[model samples]
Target: MTASAVKQGQTTTGHALPILSLAVGTFGIGTGEFAMMGLLPDVARSMDASIPQCGNIVSAYAMGVVVGAPIISLASARMSRKQALILLTLWFAVTNILGTLAHSVGALEFWRFLAGLPHGTLFGGSALTAASLVAEGRRGKAVGHVFAGLTFANVVGAPLASLMGEYLSWRVAYLLVGAIALIAAFMIWRFIPRDDPRPGHSLLGELRAFGRKQIWYVLGVVMLGTGGMFCVYTYVSAALLHVTHVPLWSIPLFQGLWGVGMVVGAYVGASAIDRNPLGATIGAFIWNVVTLSLFAFALPHLWSVTIIIFLLGGTIALGPAMQMRLMAVAGDAQTMAASMNHAAFNLANALGAWVGAFVLASGFGYAATGWAGGGIAIMGLLLFLLSVRGEPRLERSTDSSVRFH
Candidate 1:
């Protein structure tokens, strides 16, 4: 139901229900993924592991995203996008349900990795499908709307899961995440309209996309820019504990503020991208540097840290703009590049959490993670500028987007 698809009398776009369903799945994924950041302390204590040791689970999950993106994208190239989305959520559901059965840290890492396997493909397919539904210029907003479910999860789902982990059994929290993912699968199966298989996109062509340096630069921008956010966010609870000296019970409540920032960032960033993709991308990197630097300074003051966490979540603004940028330059390998986009993101997730853990293990305070994150963001902004100096910043027209039979 793209603009071109509509003009061709193939399909007209107004399928809010399908997009809603996609958002639901995104929400479930976000809840399960982000919730762990706050609940890692609980997990660490339960497994009799150190907090830094427990952070390996985050890296494990992100590694799954990195490994799974390209493999699944290639495997599903001929399948219906709708079918792929449903199966990915089902995969997430099963993994999380099984994750509750894990007894040791190794087991926890394994199940979390399985859960991560579906992460990149689901987001990639969801973004592409959402783009297919909208027109040329508005694709950024549409993708943002679909991704809003993730940001909103930070507000509601992740915080709620943190509470569940704190008060109830953390197992119960994992069980709840599984249940939500199951519901998302059902919603995807029910709401998303059927479309025939896309045949012309060759798998070899997908590989060819990798040869382009722009794609690599885009991936690097996402990885570095996003890594900074995860560096602080992955250890938010610890910061609250050691620095802010806030009540332990207040962790989840404060975590909700981060989500509010994400929700705001998504809309604001999407609007900016709709007008100027490169400019939005530039501003997003700068935003991360400022917020992360502020977070380092603000950690001791509870109120200031709270404000900065929200602003830090605003780094999510880079997501949509970067996503659209990939599709624009990918040409025939749009699907592959789109899927790899999340691969890069979770790679960032892995790198960021690992770096955060590293900084902490080296005796740096929790606040030092912010300084590290700011430095990373500066590197990302510089790399991005170097990548796009001679390239066009505009997204490709809807006419270039995939058209289904």
Candidate 2:
């Protein structure tokens, strides 16, 4: 067959299956990734380590995201997106399996880092595929649908997996993740259309994304904005235990509720961005800041805290809007930008957790994290406003290519 025929075949196949496959793969990744947080205390006890020492696992994962995203996006520039995703997920599956057998904190941390290596690249590449499958006006929504899988993980996977770890063994959670990843890999291999690798694409060209100032602005906003959620989520169990005083059996309820919030947030945010990108972005930041503040006050009263947690999850709507913003400004470096979105979130994960830890370490207690989360959200809002003020380095053409009513 002619090379063009292969390319055409790949594109057609991608249209039919790659998007759903990507979503499924992301679901596995999301489950594997966040499940660790809920299982942290268990793993720490098993390894005879301190809780903070165990936090190194989370740090290791975030470090992998930070270092691996750009490198993978650039290094795989010559490969088909389909091939890249398959390889990434395979690696993800292997590392997760290895993580199940870790006997020491150091070993666990190393494997966690390895597990994280493909996260950003997978999300970015999968998103690119998802976007290509849709009409121009609907690209954000398409991408959002894929992300909804990850959000669903937060509601369903994380809570259930965490409960499993809490009652059973943390190793079981890792094993389950591995099984899910293997399934995702199979789905990708079977469903994702095989695209011919872009011949002219080069690592150097993708790395040029760093030259754009707008990219940095978007990254900054993403780091601060999304970090707000992490600041609270990372400590939610503790809050439920310490402040809300929920029974042990009901702890999963909070995690599940948080997931429910995420689902609603993703849907609302996805639809809102389809209508008004800018408004959605700014509104998400505001909602996070306000709701998080309320969350702090409500922690002492369980009913109010439940309401706040729901709202806390809802603020996740900012995720898709911010991702679409980066796509708009990223020019030809779409892969790098897409991958960097997860990197940004991982960074937020680290940042929010560290800040929350600092507050708790200082004896302020778990509820202090809400204030920190709110502060981070407010910072994100400020950054978004700055972007709106014509910061030359961060400006993208306001071309209305994808008109929304």
Candidate 3:
């Protein structure tokens, strides 16, 4: 069935199952992606590498996301979204198991990179599928529902994986993630509705979506705005240990609190995005500036820092609005643009970590990361302004039905 046929066939209430199934897949991806942050110490010890060297593993996974999203999205453009989701989840499960079997840091990094290959594609596909299930005006909420899994991972999956890595083995964490991925694959196969392949959708048609100036601007907004959060988060464990003087057991607690904030933010952001996507994006950026900057000052007091961490996690509320913005601006190439949103996020991951590592290496201290993050958030706000300024011209040139708001 064509997209219109599928859309017309479903009632709003019927969307629940498919969206939940997609969220399950996203939960697994989120666990596998962020679990490494908490497991970095164990991984470093196991591989006889320094903490910073283990950071390379995070960068490697992010690099794969950046490289894989567009390739997988375009390559699978003509396939049914259902088929693409299944294949992607299967790839995710297998690669994570491979990660568990790696005997050396090099091998493990390679597997992590391979495991990350499906991350963006799965999210992009899930977002598109979820959006299709709902009414047009409800697309932002649909997308947010899918991303809630990622946010919830911080609450449930990442912390559990971290605890397991701490008490058992880091390898056990990967094993658990692999299990979750397998379960997600099964749920996706059982629950997600079949989407017919886009008629006449070709690589060239997808590629041409990049020709739009607004797409580039939105991508820039993602790359810059989202990097600040990753900058602070990538090194959060180190900050908790060294700066806050927290015990190992307490780290996951803070991480879980952050996750709670994310859950709240996702729901809140969904409503905000549905109202005014551009305004929500700008507001999220501004929120990032306040929280990240405050984090620097809050570091000296554990209680204060804890609150800041929770607030910082809420910055992710920006994601659904941004995703919706890309959908509106992408025109014909929805798959590539949607997938590229996560690619841009992981690129922020790499960029933030690299920049944070540099600042730490320079002896500015762990708290300096918040300062750097705050600066990056400011840059994101400026990009949002630039995009806003150009909106009128972009609106005239594109389809009138696809409103950025």
Q: Which stretches of model 3 miss by more than 4 angstroms? A: 1-9, 392-400, 403-405
- Which is the leading candidate under TM-score? 3
Mark the regions of model 2 whose C-alpha exceeds 4 Å error after superposition. Answer: 1-17, 391-405
lDDT of 1 by residue, 295-405 (tens): 889999978987888788899999988888887778778778888999998988888887888898899989999999999899999998898777663443233453322
Better of 1 and 3 by TM-score: 3
The deviation in Å at residue 140 for candidate 3 is 0.5
lDDT of 2 by residue, 1-405 (tens): 122333354443345556677778888888887887888888988999988889889999999998899988888878888788889999999999888888999999999998998999998887777766655556677778888879888878888888888889989888888888888889888876567777787567678889998788889999999898888888888788877898877767787788788889988888878777777777888899999878789998988998888888887798888888877777778789888988998999999998888888899888888898999989999988887675442223224442210
- Ranked by lDDT, top first: 3, 1, 2
The residue-level lDDT of candidate 3 at 119 comes to 88
TM-scores for the candidates: 0.95, 0.93, 0.95
Instruction: Write model 3 residue lDDT over 251-326, tens digit each, in one string.
Output: 8898899999999888998878877665677778889899999989998799899999999889998888788888
Model 1 lDDT-worst window of ten? 396-405
Model 2, residue pairs in steric clash:
155-259, 214-394
lDDT per prediction?
A: 0.84, 0.81, 0.85
Candidates 2 and 3 compared: the better one by TM-score is 3
